[model samples]
Target: MEASPILIAIDFGTAFSSYCISVNSGHDTSKKTERYETETVILFNENQEFEKFGVEALTAYTKMTSSEASRYYFFQNFKMELYNQKITENLMISTMDSKQLPALKVFSESLRYLKDHALKALSETVAESLVLPQDVTWVLTVPAIWDNAAKDFMRQAAQKAGLIQDILSENLILALEPEAASVWCKQLPTSGFIEEQAGILDKSTVQQQAGVQYVVVDCGGGTVDITVHEVLDDGSLKELQKASGGGWGGFSVDSKFTAFLRQIFGPVLWEIYKNEHPAELQKMMHTFSIQKCTEKEDIYIECPHNLAKLAAKNKDISSYFSQLEGACWTDGNIKISYEKLASFFTESIKNILEKIKEILDTPEISIDFILLVGGYASSSLLREAVKREFGSRYKILCPYESQLAVAKGAVIFGTDSKIIHSRVSALTYGINMSRKYDPLLHDPKKRRVNKAGDYTYCTGLFLNLVSKGQSVEHDEDAQYTFFPVDDDQTEAGFRFFSTEKLNAIYIDEPGLKEIGSFVLPMPDIRLGTNREIHLKIKFGLTEIKANAIDTSSGEVQKIKLKFMSE
Candidate 1:
């Protein structure tokens, strides 16, 4: 008898991570059985070896003595290291003690811990029977705004964690965070979400039926990922705009709070305290994080005794409070004024509002609702800010347990990858090719003479594969056939380039960047210039997939573009 198939979805976040599990019993694939979430933190012992992960890591590190913790390496919010970063296999991240560790080790071990935890939970339910790895499917969620290199790096980490046997394993799925949330939102009823106005019946906003258009703002700890979607008649979701956003997220508020702290304490003293009291600082920040999400007017954050003592060493602590504008030093606490606490969210909320307006201004999009999800979306200040700004024009809705939306949504997506019917291309993508030189259009500098010295070609001509904002169906492919430029060409290479500007004409344009490249071996020289390579790129999925077919030999090969060096 075949074993019951299990699906585990991991929403690996910057400040927090969560996993959701579902068992596919007959036709019931979306029934969630278990869900768990924890902080995205890891701690290493003095030997620089792995110690603990998630909540355990935070607790253990916090319990250690200052001298003992000084030698330990604790890492949190490390996911932001991959944002707009030049990712490579050798990338290293710094821990609390300013010690460096291979980024791959940290990511893989964190994932490994989550996988083991989920498996352990499954084991208990099976009653003395072991759950076979083959019966489990894993889905990992990443921000939709992340580049291909970052996504590839996460996949490599998952492989190293033994989540899957190989990169090409069918058991592993990479689901975009915003798209996953959109899927989860679609499955929810009108009652699942919280609206400032009670019993409001705006069809577009309240109803979850066809033709309802909304924008999903996945505000997580590291980044705010936004995407527009329209409900289709077939119950599938179609993306109206590509995923876009900035680093303005929940952590941005924390940064603002930290800046305030630095201003109160001199820079030198602050640095010393951060270095010496890293564990205490972490605990203080953790407390601030909780207070930040509470729906309260005036907030009081307990000051760490050590931080206050350190500040007192340099100057009068009372003088510092006297000069403070938005907060006062109270009984062992910092009594932050309501206006001051709101200031922490100002930058993040401003950026989010601006982006939302930009998306709404698009001529083609007509959104009636703004759906907020993720850890940051749960912030009361952020919610109030968003509602105050655009509440009149659009209905603002935030679901219960918004933090777990991504993880639960990922499970739904893993069960049905086709839930999102199409996606808009985020960037204009093209291949660099040599074309017959036209005197009127081709640049003189790009003109190249063939080895035969008879014909001239433009070396940096852009062969457009997809344009920015173009909607592409999920399973559809953009096919193109190309012939060797030279008769004796030993290989045909496809150099991929992308740019934010839609009107880029050349591969070397100012904004154009060479992202990746793949080379196809042309073993059959007899075909000469007549040999043709058929290339197809799937642009609608979360990650681009490409394949090449040699017509002469009917050989098809999957093309994995080489990114940065290992």
Candidate 2:
């Protein structure tokens, strides 16, 4: 209890959440809420009230109409919303900010509380302890499907919390979620588990638990992320592709379940459900109502068969639960059976597994086992559905703290990268576009450039040499040399290329696919208009710097691509 720890793995998940400290325990013992942890988020409010978190937060917000509890419950895998501008709000709007707090802020506040709790726990345990760990590093897990902006937002929230709370001496950062699952699962297998197929843990254990070549349909609170990984040549593991990111997650699933309940029971005894949960009825309609994608399934509030039956003018909501199990699932009102839930999941698993099959068409990219990690991976419905789609040819792996696996694995990665710079690598090239000059501008020369003249045709990636899943990274400068394609036009009038739609080429059957691609700057060029173009790429932490020069003429210019900094 004397030495304080420097790093902690934080799995801030969708449904349930947990964290693991670097310190390991021996034999059969308690991991106490202190050493290793999970929490039902009953947050302490400014007024010293123990507010809701976890499943409690869920039920509370579901019945709420006020924005406070409703807004705090952004269950969209809040971590992933950081990068994108457009978002769908199925949940009611509420937040500390009267104007509406961004999802990330609410998420941060939750973590801030967790940090405070951790600090208090540490202090309490060590009555008069000396020699505590000097550094404090956070290894935070996020959904693998999250984009840069989502990740950026998480980093920002972490920084704000770290600064505002003054809770740590230093903060080293490591981020990854599903990838961490692969690593931790490989490490925490049972003794009898086979090693040859271990992702990071044991091969046999995976087979006993998950299934082979199986796709892990991790339906969590915010988003469902599917990862397909292959066993490496040395029997290690390598991620092949991110199969899917969906709106279908635990909260969504529960919401659907809730609606289905009311549909069947709305005419029966609603008192039981209401008594068990006083605000249950309101919770369903206002905050966390059951939602459906089916065109046929129209959900109506639970009401007694007659207003006078309950000796009241309004419907007796208590009658709802009596018929909760009577839902007509074919109409999508509720999940009628385990089979039905499994089938619902089966379709989604098939959709993503089909994509994985396409990507791994090459035997070189084949995966042997599917790894399952996340709160909802514990679902009996999802587990069997995954087994059905991707059967026994490959094994499936699941970890104890399945939801927290990513964060823990992130910590392990952080440990490695903290010692070696090359250990932590990323793909970086400014997102750019192609432009057209006065002349020699092919494609859409006469196309009207908009008022911004910051036309889609004028800005695109400078160099996109790094593709997803590519491991070509170093602390070294991102340098790429591009001689004009034609090389003989007037100072190749350089125009970057960007369009409402990205141009991409295909790669099936010896053809090209235009998944997405943009033109680099439209270079205004002539035989000797410019001898050479010198480009320097600089990225320090969260900043990007690009310096371009006409070496022949000694003209230098720097491009600030960022319209507004994060």
Q: Tell me the TM-score of each prediction against the true structure.
A: 0.92, 0.59
Task: Kindly list the per-residue Cα lDDT of model 2 for residues 184-223, writing each as its tens digit.
Answer: 5554546422223435333443423332343444556667
Error of 2 at 334 (Å): 12
Q: Residues 295-411, candidate 1, lDDT per residue (tens digit)? A: 667788888888889878877676788978989888888888878988898888999999998988999778878999999998878888889988889888888889998998888
The residue ranges of model 1 lying beyond 4 angstroms of the native Cα positions read 1-4, 25-32, 126-129, 132-134, 196-208, 437-458, 485-490, 503-505
Q: State each model's CA lDDT, in order.
A: 0.85, 0.45
TM for candidate 2 is 0.59
